[model samples]
Target: MKLARLGVLIDEAAMKRLHSYGLNVFERYIEEILEHAGAPFETITDIRALDDRGFDIVIASVVPENEETAERLWQYAEHGGTLIAYGGLGLLARRLGCRQRPRTGAGYARLPEFRSVPAPLRCLSAQPWHAEDAGAGAIGALHASSPQGELVGPALQTFAVGRGAIHRWAVDIPTTVVQLQQGTRPVLHDGIPAPDGTADIDEGILKADDDIELDWEWDREKTATGMPYFAYPHADYWREALMAHLVRCALAKDRTLPLLDYWPEGTGHVALISFDSDFNEDERAVVTLDVLKKLQIPSTWCMIEPGYSPQVYERVLAEGHELALHYNALEKENGIWSLEEFTRQRQWVQSATGLARVVSNKNHYTRYEGWGELFRWCEANGIAADQTRGPTKRGNVGFLFGTCHPYFPIAWCDEGNRRYDVLEIGFLTQDLNHPNLSDTTVIEPFLKQVAKVGGVAHFLFHQIHIHRLEPVRQAIREVVGKARQMGFAFWTSKQINDWQRARRTMRVTGIDAAGQVRLERGTVNEPVAVWLPTSEAPESIQSPGIVYRYGVPCIKQVHHLTREEAEC
Candidate 1:
């Protein structure tokens, strides 16, 4: 099989060092680009020879300002050459075409202090962004050093490439933290190097480009199916690297990867079958509850009680599983509940948990989005999470093609009624699959699949699934055992239960004339993203707000709604 050739068009020491880290054929001062990724190619190095060889990609790693190399490769050869250029990149962008993307996206974790572009290009691209055990990566940002003092980041600027198909910050992803002397490119966020000419992203932090590999270790644990679930995030290091490579590949000025909380994490997909229930107080609930108690596994219950069985619902509370008002009352109406009728059902939940239901309804028969009015009512009433976007009572799948996980609700618990305050937790599995174990006994396969996609198994197990699956129940114990053996951690659903609980407190305190935060409640262990209304600063929230009782920042924003609408 013929392999594709990649040209390394540089003679500089820096270029030589950089090429060592990449894969594929490296051409020095290659004249032409690889014409295709179709098949392997015979090797050729002469710059002029590139025209005849028909290579597809060219990696220009030298001082792009050097007109000789730029003119040769820039003019001749393949339609698009993947260029690893610096100065020449912007120039090519102008020729190849370019546009503006708002700085609002993602990729820039450490924002450069000054928006000003310095005089010289001197900066480090590597600075550790996480804890020591958090593994490591080659962090790159644009930095500059002046004839003056220390180096700092370049100013902020966005440039489009490839007819607006791609976007690059001129966004500095440099590893050198050296102070760049001005005359730098558009990546406005720049930083300068220290006195020593030595500047890597965070200067001197990274030594020997050979040791640099773009990989980060995710703290991993196993899902019930014994597949790995990473507790921490992967792709933090590679995502930006991949984006840069992608832009370089497109050879377009418009190429850009979102720095916003993008979806690099949810790529994997699958679901689990729960083996427990929360609605009835029959032996089914008792048997299922006993196993969950013995196994130390936390499950979610779809509770159904119209002041009928307080002990049953209360037992779910005592059993240590999440409680969602199961719509038994509304099941007859095609499992749909009227807003007011739904309210009466969960009215007794306070007796169970002593707190207003923070989570919403999960319809029985595994129906999805059945009780819309009930959900809306729950939302208006102080609830913030809903788990109804799964199989309806018919136990049908495939209506959901691929998506499975927690997503922001398109609307409140109400159909077609949107609310930003609610978090929609979708159901991935239920108890029916266990007894039917037929072909859809996807308990393990689904769990394994969901784990692959960085998803949680939001199961609605009834008393039957576990209590009956003698072997399967034992299998649950083994799954937990294997997880512990593999260094994975299991979290009680209530912990996340609380996380959803805390999200509602976010408020827009006051807007600056620039629309920056005059006030925002900086709570503990939460995602607090504050943006300038102008959108320049976007939304930036850091840990430790003024609310911190202990010098550490913590507290809620002032201003609370007088009363919340009613919910289950």
Candidate 2:
């Protein structure tokens, strides 16, 4: 097989120093890796007149400067090509005119080692959108917040175009000394191979205890200021990133990337909690039950058919918890049910729950593949709210999906309203990931968030998931105690739905003097500190919630049967 060919494009700032904010040191590293990649490679500071006849993918990177310039680079991708960039997301999406801002600090990077998470986009981190020029099959890996305090994984994402591929990365560049690569791009090979790309060395650094050596060369070129790399070792790390991104462009795969799930703007704020069996699988449910029992907090549980160990379901129903059907076929993980199967399962659970009027439903694993048909079936049969989504599977699949809160929405986007409305309850972190999260930290981070906008925290704890951990009950007890202390109140799915009437009324009535723009629900003036919806600033705001979209100061309620005042 023949080797691949690539062209490197960078601004003038990258050429002077081999390792600076732009491309200095990266050029040397790029040369080494391309040579090692067993392919013809070329580098140019000017993108104007490059002969594009023989290259594969384009690599782009982010800096404290030149952000706007990055936008112009999309032409390369739009013209049936591929690209990679050194930028973080959430903020990245917002920056690219996605029209929405990040809320609270949702897209944060927490690397304890760095004492850093993508901190409020002062310079290091940013909210950017994917290049729309690239096709929708783009694979995106974002900065995941982990316990290491605040570290972003060297992540990578890719997409396909007409006869080409586009790749983007938040990665660590390669270098001659340590032979390292960091950022979000994937590593293809390891070592400072021979001129023809053969190897014999420990190249890159993976996270601790996971010895995955990096692949490629660590080429260091001299600069006048000697600050070729940015600050600290990060210079070398970024250099490695530039190389890895280019390499991915050279050897990307041919497959489809999953689309993220997002709620449409008009969807209201809602919460969905199912009262079902612990099956004893989830580690937190039992303790959660204990907590709810003590707090006397009412909740709705979607009882799973046949899976609900009869006795538990009876007790849950007797406890007066609202019962709804949680549907799933006989086979668990690999099961794919048809519309009939879904309908049958729902009816079976409804009968077993003994609720002659089982009017609500949520799906197990939140996977209702044919939701459109299922929701339609629900509407025809009197289901009120379809509450089957949250911090599902992996929480990163966030984008635009269509429902916001518990709303009477036109069910599926394309098919129009099918009668059954799907409500989107915001998500809370799963205990499995943050087992150390006592009831204290769980509510601490979310309090200021709720106090400001009144969104639901939606924490999940199964009896089993919680029982596996020590002092589980205390964690539950603390959460209940804190709710009382915070002066905030709780609302079940049904109650919150009922309250939207008053809330919406208050919202529109309190419309600010601005007199223009629309107002969304959860708008409050109760000493609220928001993650301002503009790229203005984030240095000060005691409140810690992150907002990904802007607000127009309308009160949090709906007035008459009509949309209110317009811009003057």
The best candidate in terms of TM-score: 1
Q: TM per model?
A: 0.41, 0.40
Q: If candidate 2 were superposed on the true structure by all CA atoms, what would the RMSD be? A: 19.4
**What's the lDDT for residue 326 in model 1?**
60
Model 2 Cα lDDT, one tens digit per residue, 1-568 = 1233345565444443323322223223443333222223456556553335444554443222344444444545556566555443233343332332232122222222221112211112333344443433333233423212233332344454345544444332322211211112123223233232221222332111011122111211112422111111222223223433343343343211111011112333333334444363322444555666777766776666445555656766576567666666334454445667667766777677566766666666444333255556666566666655432322111111211223332232234212234343433433423343322343443443333333454554445545566455555556556655766455566555444323332221111334221323343212211111222234443324333321211112122223332211
After superposition, the stretches of candidate 2 with alpha carbons farther than 4 Å from their true spots are 1-274, 278-290, 307-314, 329-335, 392-404, 407-420, 432-442, 466-468, 501-568
The whole-model lDDT of each prediction reads 0.36, 0.38
Tens-place lDDT digits, model 1, residues 2-112: 112444444444343444553111122122111110111233334455455554444443433445544555554324433343222444433443322222222223232
- For model 1, the local distance difference test gives 0.36
